[model samples]
Target: MIGVMREGGLLVLTLQRPDKANALSKAMLSDLLAALDDPPQVLILTGEGRVFSAGADLEEAKAGLATDPIWDQLSNRIATLPSLTIAALNGTLAGGAMGMALACDLRLAVPGAKFFYPVMRLGYLPQPADPARLVALIGPARAKLILMAGAKIEAEEALAWGLIDRIVVPEDLLTTARALGADVLAAIPGHASAIKRLIG
Candidate 1:
């Protein structure tokens, strides 16, 4: 399930299946796709409880690989959004979920958050774009360690490696994200978009 709400000009999307650690399901991905069609100046993606997302639902995955297309579409949409995007990581992130976070323009994570990519370990290959973005953020060597070696990166290390922009205390995660979003919104309207075009 997905939870959608607007805070001023910011759109906040929360993955709502805490029981399953907010794993991405077909319905949830569909909801996310629909929400991505039109977004405000700022968008924040996060999850309910403590987990941001555990990637695709393994239960559905065992049924077939039908979810691949939807996953790619969602990742592409977020990566190319015209608006500034943020991934407010509430907890551990893995697999396709890491791809989503990497697509964001900025990331703020809870101090306890950890990032890992288990694609290789699980006998799955990550989407090509995912690694491209990872390489762009942290460089090919570090990206290789994560994607090929399945390295577990803690929040502080992630920040040091430039994978995440900031580490926020649990209580202030959303508040800090909002403040950063507000700063984006308050900037000259077209400047941010133009900058995104030039750099991205």
Candidate 2:
């Protein structure tokens, strides 16, 4: 359920299960995690449908996937990646998938995309490292609004709250992501990594 395309040092990973709203299955999560093993200089993650992810696959969630350690593992890997990671959100981001998107260095979403975690309503805890990252991006109160209060924030509110960096038209999403990464992709050997390290 992941499609990988690599060009030079740029890597793009797309969630491919559109019919399922890109709901992640165990195998799909594994594939996505595996894709990050050999870190690229610039990484962009986007989805192939109207929803980036509806979180865990329904059947898999019923089988305890909601609390799986792999979710934390995957998000952590993205969080610690030396390369610049961008979540080029093709659509709405929901549930557990919020971890991966929040972990990215920057987020660019389509105009109509919505952001919500809904874990409070679902009766499940978020991945271990997710809350801090979310809080860092949007502040504790705003993070609680989405996580504890189950607020469904749309693109504008998300941008203003700092949950997402920018909103781009669907057609320009990938183009904008690539443009944002151009400097990193063309940087001297360690320049991008050095800047990322300095930021943290």
Candidate 3:
């Protein structure tokens, strides 16, 4: 379930199924994909509970969800967005979920959040774009540490490694994300987006 909240020009997309560790079901993935089609100037992607996402829903994963092409499609769309996208990692980020976060413009995670993409251990490969993105934010060696070696990174280490931009307190996660997007929201219609394009 995806909970979309619009605040002025900012839209906060929350993964609403906490009972399942906010796992991404096929329906939830479809909802998220739909939500991104009309993104605001600043989009904040976060989760409702203590876990941003435990990756694909286990049941769905067993049924071939893990290798779905939609995963590649979703991550690619996020990467090409004109808006300033922020991933507000509310908690642990694992498995396939890393793709979306890796594609974001910036990542802010709570202090206790953990980051890992266990594709190696899971006996599956990450989406093609995902590995390239992961290497871009961090480095190829560090990317290998997680994707190849299955390393579980804590928020602090992730931040230091450039895997995440900031380590915010849980209570201030959304507020901080909103604040980070303030300038973008206030800028001329395409000013921020133009700057983002230049940076890329």
TM-scores of the candidates in the order shown: 0.94, 0.98, 0.98
lDDT of each: 0.86, 0.93, 0.92
Q: Write the per-residue lDDT of candidate 2 for residues 38-70, one digit (tens) a residue.
A: 999999999998999999998999899999999
Write the residue-wise lDDT of candidate 1 on 73-92 in tens digits.
Answer: 88889988878899999998
Model 3 Cα lDDT, one tens digit per residue, 1-200:
78989878898999999999999998988888898888689989999989999999999999999989988888888888889999999999999999999989999999889998999988999988898999888899999999999999999999899999999999999999999999999998998889999999
- Measured with C-alpha atoms, the lDDT of residue 41 in candidate 1 is 86
Candidate 2, superposed: residue stretches over 4 Å from native: none
Candidate 2 clash pair list: none
Error of 2 at 94 (Å): 0.3
User: Which residue runs does candidate 3 get wrong by more than 4 Å?
Assistant: none
